[model samples]
Target: MSTSPHILLITPPLTQLNTPYPATAYIKGFLGGRGYTVTQADLGLELVLKLFSKEGLRRVFAEIEAGPYQLSDNARRMLRLKQSYLNTVEPVIRFLQNKDNTLASRICHSRFLPEASRFDNVADLETAFGTMGLSDQARHLATLYLEDLADLIKETVGPQFGFSRYAEKLAMSATTFDALHEALQAAPNLLDQMLLELADALMAKVQPDVVGFSVPFPGNLYGALRLAGRIKQISPATKTLMGGGYPNTELRTIQEPRFFDYIDFLTLDDGEGPWLRLLEAISCQLPVASCQNEQLADVVQNNLATGNRQLATHQLQRTFLRNALGEVEYHNSPQPDIPHAEVGTPDYSDLPLTEYLSVIEVLNPMHRLWSDGRWNKLTVAHGCYWKRCSFCDVTLDYISRYETAPSTLLVDRIEQIIAQTGQTGFHFVDEAAPPLALRDLAIELLKRRVTITWWGNIRFEKTFTPDLCRLLAASGCIAVSGGLEVASDRLLALMEKGVTIAQVARVTDGFTQAGIMVHAYLMYGFPTETAQETVDSLEVVRQLFAAGIVQSGYWHRFSMTAHSPVGKNPAKYQVAPVGPEPGPFAWNDLWHEDPTGTDHEAFGPGLAKALYNYLHGVALQEPLSFWFDFKTPRATVPRHLIQQALQEPGKPDAARPNNRLFWLGNTPELRYEAGKKGQQAVLTFFEQAEDFEVKVPAPLGPWLQTLLTSLASDYDTKVLLKDAAQSFPTAGGQKWEQFLLSAGWLTLREKGLLVL
Candidate 1:
């Protein structure tokens, strides 16, 4: 065997159907750039593609028929239409992938697809699809058809089958590994069998010396372990490693030796450092096949220490391995994590891009963006710039360790990703994309003339001025989602959100005014929040929707996690951590008694119903009590709170000397014409679909023309507003500030001029 081991990275099944999660792609890019052989795959998409094909449905039908389980009317109806399903499944798959658009009309009109239980309760077709094109309409129907089959699988052979998650219940806040371990020990279910088959085939093909699974969610934990177990059975020499969002938060204090029976190493926090160290430890003098868990720990502890000074004392940065004594041992190396800039562009090379299913499970515009199409996932920065939100896992490395790359470097990666994937869409998966970083990124994208459509998360800071929002939109930002968590000002301050209801209203209104979609993440439960506060928060959300400030929103029931501020010191928030008690395997989410809050659980259904109606443009005029079955406190918030907030005039711009000026519209054509007093300069500007003219005296015209031209130049120019003002011509004794209020200047400002 080669002295250097090849790496195979994978994203576990059922995280997403519309896009490949970026974890494996990121690792593959970083590791492969270091000249380490790396191959990556999205096993979820592969398993999905395999299970939903014509032949796959034949197998599914036959398997269900062979089984001895009671079938629901839906399942029975689907089974009866098995032939029709088998005939249309492949075509439906093709059409959903945008490979066969010709089938959309037939699917919509010809009864080409079998109607099943999933279609039984679909909302009015006209209301849902009236504005959507034919293709989108058909895609939603195909999505439901798949859901119908998914229901059959879950109800019969695979109770764990879900489009977005697998065995999630077993892993959600699973403090103990007993249930997960027991489930793993059982015989493979149908879905598990399919996953194993994919993994086995992959291992046989790659024969990699190391296999790493990126488990980004609780749903992925079981899938990762299940496949890692199979990898061990196939090749004990193949080192199995697991790390990601799940372990980063859940398995920090892992003490279960049984967990190591599945994977050789479990890494916490950022994986890049730990994986590099772990590899050095594994590539020891011991023969690869002979290096079992105990011997591997020995190699990590004894051999690697002598070989590498950074790994002295057998340290592996933030990693856990089973020791020779049949116990789990955590190891750490002092080596810092690989810097964000140094980690190369995420490689989407080995992933089956076109094969990913773009399923539409939701009808709301902003919500459907998650499931509608592929978006090249990128990061604006390494971590959250504002990591002070009490409810957030701000203490975790992913949030706490903030870092940013240069704007040019970020755009360089963007171009590289677009070139590779042939996709111009991006989703910056940052904790909260820093506002200043996004500004620079947007400017860089414009300067480089990189055309792309993108969106990401951000904090509702006042820095997102209307002008700045327009600047972002000009650079192709389509939508942004941010936390409007606990809209009550008191609770917001308690959570350290650094924003109030009025501030969110202004910022979201700014984004909306700039023609960008805004989605708000709202929270219901918080310490010291009363029922009246809950009602008021709902009222605020309702007005936000009614006033068209926030286009979409989601209300989350607050769950305290161990890494968050509140979870760490519950007493400070006037809450008690009534926990299952931290156990050996998984422990992050802490059950807390928010003694001062209302019955949070009781509001979940009403909140969901109200939000659902609001999303669909329904029931906004109904009383807040209409959503809740029980009597609720009357709204303390005013009827037009958001309207009044929106009506409030924005503060005048402060033209700081260093503030940059640029033109986002097309270059203007300057000409001279007759004026009342003298020759007038007329600058004709062309926007996307319209053209307008700005007139000024000839002398002032040339000066303004030159400034606008320089600002709009293809090169990345730094024409500060102060610099432009200082260079103003003394035409008719018009002051620089006076000229700013002129119709010509105002028109230019309205037509895409940005002073940011």
Candidate 2:
């Protein structure tokens, strides 16, 4: 018998996207390093793609027709135009998948495809009617077509049906296991049927000794449990396990036996340590089970009888396992927490790279980052550096703990990832990447001559100086998103955000000046936030856009969570608990009420509408009260607050140039050299800067090289050619300069060639 366990890592249904979530990738990499034969399957993306195919649509329409539920007008129309849908479904999917650009013109044509209720919005029509709008229209129509089918599935098959989430209604804020258990026992929907088929296919292909389900969100919970139950039913010998963000947060106090009926073990926090120990325990018992032809329970009992008390202990540190009596046993691994460097590079080899759909439901350019392209997700650190936010789950391990690998290690990982995945785009999925760590990483990336476009979340703090921002942009940073939540200094202080409005404006302005796009994560309705404060916060947000400091932003209403400081001590913030605490099954998003009696819920729609208009540059001068339907007290915020903050304290210097250069093209010619014997690489380049020519070892040299190579070029080629004679040293120099100028190596500036 093979001593090595065959582990199959599964991403459950409804979390489909252009790229797989990083959970399985991280787990796969960690386990693979330990010499385990691991395979991963993204049943989520597969299920959605399958359901949207021509044959799948036909089955859906047939199901809708045969079902007893009342059909919406859109559903009736889809049934009527079933033939057109069937004919266009695959082609539409191909177009959306970026497989066939030729289908775009066909799909854009109004008569080529059927439309439904999702196209009823006037904004969607406007987008469809805009210049070269056909592709956009086609994508929207395709999304609508899928949504119509999803609705049909939801109405007739399962009420919880969605493309990215299934049975979420039964999972979110589920205080008891009864709802989820009842959901599992209920009739299978179209989604459930498709997931079961996928589960069976995966099990047959891998024939694994262990199956691990990664449940990242509440929506993925039901599908994960359902899949695990099916796996246990068909292959009773397989050891089933569950872990991920949802389980780490929700299943902490697991009193429910029904959960164990599906999976034998539930690991928490970082899965690396617990998983290793669990595998070792299983491997030790496997031989006994094989010899006696006994079930896993007997083997477990035999191990316990033989004084394997460590594995038999119910209160183990990080792992919750099942014992001989079918009772859940919690065990803490004796192993220390794995270092960040040892987690290994996230392996994306098992995922279907090309088949994932890049859906574009919203035409907003900034929001497109979530769905537009595949980004290799990586973490700068193990957890958050600042887990002090009152509304945050600061007590949780994922937030409370903070550890980071060296900058050299980070770049090494990046290089490895690039070689493995053949992709240069990365998304840092950190809770909040520390500013100092980012600075060091940026310098290291430049020193090693590594090049990649990346973006991530950060805290809008004063550490991000203008010079630092410029350095980051020089190192291929395109965009940055950070929390500017609540935008009011008083509430910001109360929330312990550690940054004021004035500070945020300056920091964001620095990023904007450095040619990087800025996206702000705004919040409203924090405990004790007044109506006037809410109005004033919108003013700050508007001024941020008006000053062109922030390009994109989103606002979310705050909800208290159990692990937050506010939840633990509600009266300190003058808020009282409104509902009973969440029970054993799931416990995030607790209800609370402010004694101040501010109707925070009423401001949501207006704030969203105002933001929508603000993002599109439609309403800048509109009154804060104008967004709200009812009479709202005029915003008391000073109109010139942002403008005043932007003005520097000292007088402008006549000798120093105020203007900074910007890169024009999407790509530039540059090379990074790694110096020998622990020395930094020497960098050489040309562009607009204080110095035009220089050679030095990194970290400073590479930054200058990147900056010089990225200067803006928007002038006519003929003009640059004509001016080359005056700028060059000789006739031959002029000719060479002209060639370089024409090739975008140089550009004409009023002062001189802007290079350093």
Each prediction's TM-score against the native? 0.96, 0.84
Q: Any runs in candidate 1 off by more than 4 Å, and if so which? A: 285-313, 654-658
Q: Rate the local accuracy (lDDT) of all candidates.
A: 0.86, 0.76
Residue ranges of candidate 2 with Cα displaced over 4 Å: 122-138, 288-316, 324-327, 649-685, 688-756
| Maximum-TM-score candidate | 1
TM-score of 1: 0.96
On residues 229-316, what C-alpha lDDT tens digit does candidate 1 reach at each position? 9998989878889999999999999999999988988898878788777776666633432222353556445554565322222657
lDDT, residue 336, candidate 2: 79
| True-structure Cα RMSD, model 2 | 9.3
Q: What is the C-alpha RMSD of each candidate to the true structure, in Å?
A: 3.2, 9.3
